[model samples]
Target: MTTSKTEGKQCNLVNHDEIWKVHINMELESAKSWPQKWGFLTESYNQAMQESSKVTDRILKLELPEHLRTRPPTPPEEYLETTQAFIGWRSAVPGLQLERYGRVQCGKKSFLKELGWALDGCS
Candidate 1:
């Protein structure tokens, strides 16, 4: 009985050691394959970077002729104030659609009347 117990313990130890060796081998294989995986990831990242650079270049080239790109000098404070007031008044009027009517018969007469009164304090 004692000899058999000793043999059983040795068998268990050998099985455990085999399991540990297999795990270590798998880990080493994964480590060895890392460079290929890293290369694939790096290639994908470089392609994305190139595409983003192309999009940025296209946007900059297309937007170069707009008024925003010219950086004109600032308008006077009085002009800015007047423009803001006109914009505010136009925005306050509800559902003011001007595209549906002729210029002579449209809401422009009413709008101009109110705007003139607001500007010159005369109705």
Candidate 2:
């Protein structure tokens, strides 16, 4: 009887795993559909991929000419103290306006669209 109960629990676990796998597959399908729905043409996608490859190749081939890559003369302790002071000043500033400005500039349209959808659902 105990063996039967254990077997039943194992079967339930397998079913749960299968359900989770199906959900992940659906999400992947939705992601693939999004770019197409956004009117991304095939040639555009290919061109973008080619540009990305070129950037990647350039990064991989980069060799800084001898003068630029040389080690800095500053002692490590001085560098560490300067970095810490900069970080402390940044932290001490309350309500960093630059961060808020960036969010407002980047997210204003999307945020309002989402907020409208959410408010509509509430009503």
Candidate 3:
């Protein structure tokens, strides 16, 4: 459980910590298959963004260096334009595509790693 902060007052989840640690999972929804929505996750992510001004501000246009990008760009391939081609896809990549561009991610980094550097003061 989690609580929203309003008017600088500390709030608590009915029986749980205000700050939570949980896994929000997504499947590998390929282009060929139908899609599904994770509404609870969407709401949770939105709430997280709303709670942190710093996250909301930079979340839209995160410009991580190549090494920091969750997935490196697909490698160039030589194709005869005959068969379907996908190169450099290493593993399952889960994220939400934004309206115009960019993404909001559920990542592979450990919680402690994220706690130390994912949000503020990344180095």
Considering every candidate listed, which one attains the maximal TM-score? 1
Candidate 1 lDDT over residue span 12-107, tens digit each? 667778999999999999989998777688888999999999999888777453322433545777355566765565545444434335345544
Clashing pairs in 2: none
What's the TM-score of each model vs. the native?
A: 0.30, 0.24, 0.16
Model 2 ranges with Cα > 4 A deviation: 1-38, 72-123
Estimate the overall C-alpha local distance difference test score of candidate 2: 0.68
Q: Rank all candidate structures by their TM-score, best first, as comma-separated numbers.
A: 1, 2, 3
lDDT, residue 52, candidate 3: 96
RMSD of each: 17.5, 18.7, 27.9
Q: In candidate 1, which residue pairs get closer than 3 Å at backbone N, Cα or C atoms, i.e. clash?
A: none
For each candidate, the alpha-carbon lDDT, in order, equals 0.66, 0.68, 0.48
Worst 10 residues of 2 by lDDT: 96-105
Give lDDT: candidate 1, residue 91.
48
Off by over 4 Å in 3: 1-37, 54-123
Candidate no. 1 TM-score: 0.30
